[model samples]
Target chain A: MELSVIGKYKLLVARLYGELDHHGAGEIREAIDRELMRRGVRNLAMDFTNMGFMDSSGLGLVMGRYKKVSAIGGRLIVCGMNNNIRRIFQMCGLQRIAIVADSLEEGMEELDK
Target chain B: MNKMRLEFLSRSDNERFARTVAAAFMLELDPTVEQLSEVKTAISEAVTNAVIHGYDGSEGIIVLEGTLDKNAVKFSVIDRGIGIRDIEKAREPLYSGKPEMERSGMGFTIMEAFMDSIEVESAPGKGTRVTMTKTVEAEDEG
Candidate 1:
């Protein structure tokens, strides 16, 4: 998987591409965490618009990041999930912990509120 | 029915390969996008279980088999590695055998949700086999 992280205004936006599975989660997690720590970013927004496939591992990645951000009084927003990904998120009850948005713009707006 | 089987090392990198092969094999069924995604997700979960829980970071082999019938598809992921002792507890949502790894423990739950039926057979010292099936609704031709 490929990931791009942009940090601004104390928020980090990660755009993930390709499939996310156990094989890729560890590296992605480390990369994101590095960015989060280096920039002292508070809130996080994950853009899944280009992600074509995900499984339970994706849930683990999101949950782990949520714990990290929330512990620091930051918010987590997951945006641009396809119907299939959304189903997995709902099945895992991810909506309970992370803010679900349709797009990155919407997620940023929610973080502002 | 058309059938195919693939055996690969239980490495983390092979997880995506296994699921993608399953999806390609199921194309014979001409499943809808949603149906394909569901089957792919289920395959991913089962293969991941074999890689992570079954082998436990050690190198082993994972066998993925796919069968396509008139309106349904079946898949089996098998591993000859350490198996779960308690199937019931393992199937529970949010129950990770390796919590330190930050696993969501939703593998079995996702498999059950996407597939029409799921069956798991394992012996603690023997191995584990997960079989899942999904029925595809035939779309009307225009």
Candidate 2:
């Protein structure tokens, strides 16, 4: 999967393109963590608009990232989930830990709150 | 009934390959987009379980067998690797044998949720086989 990370002020928006599977989550995790550790970057917004497929592995990726941001006293918002992804999130209870937004703007707004 | 079997290495890269092949095989059934997605997710979870837990970071072989009937599909992901010692415990949500690997441990749960029926058989040092079935009702056309 290809990932584009843009950090502005305290929020980092990482948009993922392609599938989020075990094969791809590792690289994506490292890339996102690298940006999360950057100075002054506190909140994280993961954009899934371009992501076509995801499985339980993606759940692990999101849960792990949530732990990281929580450790730093920051929060994580996941946006642009398709119906299939929404079902997975609901099944895995990811919505309880991370903010689930309908769009990137909504997620950023939540982060700002 | 139509049947196909695929054998591939337990490498992470083949995860997508396995999902795509399963999707293609179920096309003859004309599954709905949601059904297709659910089946793909179930297959991915089973295959990934074989790759990560079954092989445990070691290279092994995984066999995906698919069969199609009228409006129904069955898939079996077989792995000749280390088997789960406690089947009941492993099926629990958020139970990962390799937590350090960042596994959500929802693989079995996802497969069970997305499929109509699931059966698992394994013996330690022998192997494990996960069989799942899903029926896709034809959508009515106005």
Candidate 3:
């Protein structure tokens, strides 16, 4: 997982790589949580741009992030879901919680507003 | 008839491993993304149930066999674990032999939803075997 930040207000963009199963969710949860607090990031955009696979554990990651952002008086947005990952989002109804978009620009656009 | 067989040690990691193999094997079916996801998810649910519920987290062997039968694909997950007492009851929604694992008890339901045909054969004190078949039937322009 590679994480980078750009733009003012310091948006934390996490580029997830590999499968998001239970075997790997613990690291992801801790990684994302640490970054969220360390960066003091309010508006967050998770770029699944490089993510190849995700399961229920991955869905839990998204849900946990949503709760974190809500607690901080911030907003959460996720983008770059491929066809495979998008199907999971739709199946689990995670789309309703996070703003899914075509690209990072679109996601950031929604988050900025 | 082309065949591919993979055997994985019954472990949590192997559950995702089974789903990966199933997804790749179904590639030639030219399945829609939704269709492919269904297959993968169904396989995941079943494999998890077998290892977690049937075997009760004990060490075992799981054999995943894939066969290309004409226009259809036949895949079977064979597990040598404590078999289900009732096949019909097992297939019912919210019926799980193990609930402490937080299992949704929807394993068979999801598998049935994805595969065209599913068959289970087991005997008391004998291991259970669950076989699933999916045929990509051509649509008619009626």
What local distance difference test score does each model get?
0.89, 0.89, 0.75
List runs of model 1 lying over 4 Å from the truth.
A1-8
Q: Model 2 fnat?
A: 0.81
Tens-digit lDDT string for candidate 2 (A1-113): 34444465377788888889999899889988987776457778888999888998898999999999899888899999999998888987778888899998887776666
Return the interface RMSD of the candidates, in order shown, one decimal each: 0.7, 0.6, 4.1
Off by over 4 Å in 3: A6-10, B1-5, B24-38, B48-58, B78-130, B137-142
Provide the lDDT at A12 for model 2. Answer: 76
Per-residue lDDT tens digits for candidate 2, residues B1-142, read 9999999999999989998999999999988888889989999999888998899879999999999999899999999999999999999999999899899988999898899999999999999999999998888999
Q: What does DockQ give for each predicted structure? A: 0.89, 0.87, 0.15
Candidate 1 on A4-35: residue-level lDDT in tens? Answer: 44455478888999898888899999999998
A7-98 in candidate 3: lDDT tens per residue?
A: 57467778888667645666877888898888887767777888776654565567677888879877777888887677656655667777
Per-residue error for B2 in candidate 3, Å, reads 4.7
lDDT of each residue in B120-140, candidate 1, tens digit only: 999998999999999888888
Per-model TM-score (chain A alone): 0.92, 0.89, 0.89
Model 1 chain B: lowest-lDDT 10 consecutive positions = B26-35
Which runs in model 2 stand beyond 4 Å of their true positions?
A: A1-9
TM-score of each: 0.96, 0.96, 0.71
- For candidate 2 chain B, the 10 contiguous residues with the lowest summed lDDT are B30-39
Question: Candidate 2 clashing pairs?
Answer: none
